[model samples]
Target: MASSLHFLLLFSSLLYNFSIYQAKPFNPTDGLIFHVKKDVSTLQYVTEIHIGTPLLLSKLAVDLGGPFPWFNCAPSSSSRLVNKRSIQCLAAKPKTHQYQGSNKKCHIFTENRITQMAIQGDLVEDIMAINQVTDGSKTGSKSITTVDYNFQFSCAPMLLLNGLASGAKGMLGLGRTQMSLTSQISAQLSSKLQFIICLSSSNGVVLHENGHRSSNFRTKIPDSMIYTPLVNQVETPHEYVINLKSIKISGKKLSLGIEEGKIKLSTIVPYTTMESSIYATFTKAYEQTATSMNITRVSPVAPFGQCFSSRENDGTLVGPKVPAIDLVLQSEMVKWRIHGRNSMVQELLG
Candidate 1:
């Protein structure tokens, strides 16, 4: 998550109105939300979405770079909502576009970029049960109410579910597309085209209708949120890419050539990875800083090249006491700092 995963989600076009059974109807402008959590074994963040009647809950893996969301399912209850204009053939591969269907009904072509497979799925529409929270704005007490929403999603076969969380029934598309999670909810439930995703949050995910900040949910750091312009490259409009000016260790800038770096955020990867040239310079600086701090270096591990004997050193609350690794973006004032917990991984050997 640290610096590897992107800080963005997707959007969709399919719209729907909200309804409640017994209580007064909720405002259409209120934010809609679903519960999301991180799977320890697979390291994939998943969210529970209530789909179909009788409220059948389905676990979907959250993908930041993924365009449209699709899941492995039989989808007997949901009806077909095939796109009349176009259909997605391959979700993520070398080439991407609508796979045209001549005579037969079009099956939406989508895939999980993380699993690296394409799925020709039938677009299905169903009544979705979404959680709506009262922020005590119009009402004094904070309470949660379940509202029904109708939306469209793609369904694939069970064979395509590979390299994904065993418990995950499907993938949640939170990327920049016409069929992304945010876009659909924003278009239908609320007029505002914005949604908040607390990836490391312990509190419940609630969409604010009046756009008021709540003490219950917040960022990891208090009063710390950096906003920068997102660069829209026509080449990869769906991919979340941010402009990184430079990398600094202990406030010292490293030589990463003249070209400005563009980092792509990922939902699949758990840790940050760099090219050999960048790794050489980055790790060398960190190792030197660790050496000065009297931290012991151990044998190499599988994925990580630099292993440290963390037992010898009492690290900070975050992790080991090492020099700060920062990603300077846009300007010197805007910096994404990577502390110990995120910078070093603690390993246990048998």
Candidate 2:
């Protein structure tokens, strides 16, 4: 009931917003800088087309924006060449403005897929955990002292994308699109991970969004940065900006202030499959069904921090700290197995 009410409120807000919007040529300056930061990282996942191959390789690229230098955090360059395995996916474009008490005048585009898999990884290391320490005065007087805490850690995994696609669109009688994907993993990867954070009283740590960790494998690093791809962009044509007002990780919490940042949104199409024919099929489907898939803005309220020393004498004023994130994307295969009893019964009846 609570979820239903939330959906109703959200739907009403969208309807009201849509009723007021008038499409016009986009101007970058016209865009409100609702959010700003030293840097922004855009991750792009491209789907390639391959024939005769039974597998799909997930390829991605990271684009840098702002004060920081380029960081090629995406997958290997060779990943771009591999054909993406196809699942049923499509881009949706609505044909009418039926819900706004208006005739068929406006359209909206969205992505759709029958299946997809996504993995995420995280890592954190060399951090200080401060604790309050109390000590007694030497003259038999009462006194309070403070102590510091330290911990070290790292964890990684492949994550699964389990989402049922159900969103409406405006295009003709094409209607809405519905599909979903799942993740699978091997038995070898189920082992428990030990997260350790090495701490010290002397060192100061800064936490911010632009920080990053080094690649574990030599092969994943490139000699030179590969430019952003020309095709299979994940950004959408629509200009929708989103700001993360709040975030919480573990037990820690933080709020996003105007000085903390602003957001400028652009829509995108994330390539998730690897078969040429399947790629074509899903792309066409997604385009056609853009009106119905439930593309949404999910603000993840994860814990993040910015800490530095006011005193240069202490190990403060250093750069931001990079924490690692990891998740396992279990492989899922579309299998068709015949039942022995049903097969035998059919044969006997024949």
Candidate 3:
């Protein structure tokens, strides 16, 4: 009920803001930023981005593996992307069946298998207003400015909004495809591209940074930050996949028959999942280690097969004092240590 009420308030606020909008492009600044939040019920990470003139606010679900971004837009004769030479500046035009609206207008259809739905919508362009935070060395604090980015997106049908968080009008694609938001921005920049996603318990942030003047921007390093090179596969061209060399439990390597070729990072998924065989081995190993420490096991929960008695005195500041899991990446040098803080889920069962 709380989630429902929150969604309604957001939707109502959007309607109020949409009623007043002016068509005037703001001169774009150096950076573009998106403020993010996590949906409690859906477990989907969402971000807010203002679009068009006067910057109408739109909340979109962040889809890290999605190929392109789209929104559930109300049908209007506002504008269309067309030219005498080509459709959306492409050499080839879309066939009649591929499009929904008309010949002159172009559209990009994307499907979300998790929701068991597809977005068949028109390709449109709008000014995306992003709040930029720059180094305000003189002011002794971070200075902020709203940067303008001419963004290309899909104006999807109303029915396509089903199964998504109520207030999320669309999906924000962050995949590696050409139509993805980052790829589009990279095209505009015509330089090397690198983006950052920082998720937190509070409000998260996403930054679209340009690499042209690489020398100018330097981020201070934290020793705790782990690094791994991303691996690209021929099969999944649009996914950001990483090489996972092995898995360890309390510094002891687990025996495995197969090595997972790559692991894909995603925010849409609430928890980490593994292949059936690998998962079976993982749970067995965890249970063995946990029992060795005299930690009593409880009735299993849905989705999570291994359940523990949280009432036990064996607890830490972060979570239950259990064996830590480590994901050995490309090499032994880089291992993502997953402490109890990350691996345990405390559920208040009645």
Query: In model 2, which regions exceed 4 Å deviation?
Result: 1-53, 58-350
Q: Order of candidates by lDDT, top first?
A: 3, 1, 2
Candidate 3 clashing pairs, residues 3+ apart or interchain: none
Per-residue lDDT of candidate 1, residues 100-195 (tens digit): 647334466678776688867776666777777544445544455777766667778886777787777788877677677666676675565566
What is candidate 3's lDDT per residue for 90-132, written digit by digit as tens? 5212224533344666645556534858755667777776666
Candidate 3 backbone clash number: 0
A best-first ranking of the candidates according to their TM-score comes to 1, 3, 2
Query: Can you tell me which runs of candidate 3 are displaced by over 4 Å?
Result: 1-30, 75-78, 82-102, 189-191, 211-220
TM-score per candidate, in order? 0.82, 0.15, 0.81
Better of 2 and 3 by TM-score: 3
| True-vs-predicted CA distance for residue 33, candidate 3, Å | 1.6
Candidates 1 and 2 compared by TM-score, better number = 1
